[model samples]
Target: MRAIKKVKKFIERSPNSTEGITFAKLILALESENEFPVIELYQLNSDEFDLAIELLKDWRIDCFYVGKAKAFDSATRAKNLS
Candidate 1:
């Protein structure tokens, strides 16, 4: 469970990344359910955030899958936290 939280935090804030403010907005969108164009409740590896944009790819709970753009966009700075 701890590892999962870490993933979320990294997605929430990649402090070591160089993506800038766009990264932050992506974080907000990931955490937010209805605030952004996407809604991702599962955690993903930092590197995979940009390329893994599949429906029901890594979900912990089963629900309607509506895959959108990967990581909200390439502009989102996502750094590996592990």
Candidate 2:
């Protein structure tokens, strides 16, 4: 529940960001517990409460990681830096 509270704080601070909107949708899906697919799409958006708050406070809040992609050249995948 503490984590959920942190998530709420992040949303409150950046209510207009694309990430924030997606996160809001994810929370709705989670609360309904009947929209797993929608929730799945935003699973990666979840952030640690503390870190999420910091990102918001600093105004650098597009804080979710994108999925890794296959490397075009060598067979290695690109590492996620988020």
Candidate 3:
């Protein structure tokens, strides 16, 4: 939760900051399923860069679980409809 807050603050505080742009680009790259914006990570200092990576990992896991839950709910609804 602390990390999540930190990430939110990082983005909201300076959306146009170098770290923010790098983070946003990385997010876009992930959504596109392309190579990570590894080069952009260099824009951040070590701590910020590490936080970004950790946040990505956590967000990915959370998204996976949410997707799985939604699929389960859809399947259950379809089963009931039949």
Which candidate has the highest TM-score of all? 3
TM-score of 3: 0.74
lDDT of 1 by residue, 1-82 (tens): 3333444565567655543333445545554643643333224445545433321233312222333344444335454432
Q: Per-candidate RMSD vs. true structure?
A: 17.6, 13.2, 2.2
Q: After aligning candidate 3 to the native by TM-score, how far in Å is the CA of 10 from where it should be?
A: 0.8
Error of 1 at 14 (Å): 3.8
Per-model CA lDDT versus the true structure: 0.41, 0.50, 0.80
Model 3 lDDT per residue over 1-82, tens place: 6555787777888899888777777667767878875777766899998898787887788789989999999999999999
What is the lDDT for 54 in model 2?
46
Q: Which stretches of candidate 2 lie over 4 Å from their true place?
A: 36-82
Better of 1 and 2 by lDDT: 2
| lDDT score for candidate 1 against the true structure | 0.41
Task: Give residue 79's lDDT in candidate 3 (0 to 100).
Answer: 100
Q: Write the per-residue lDDT of candidate 2 for residues 10-48, one digit (tens) a residue.
A: 689988876566557656754464453434344444354
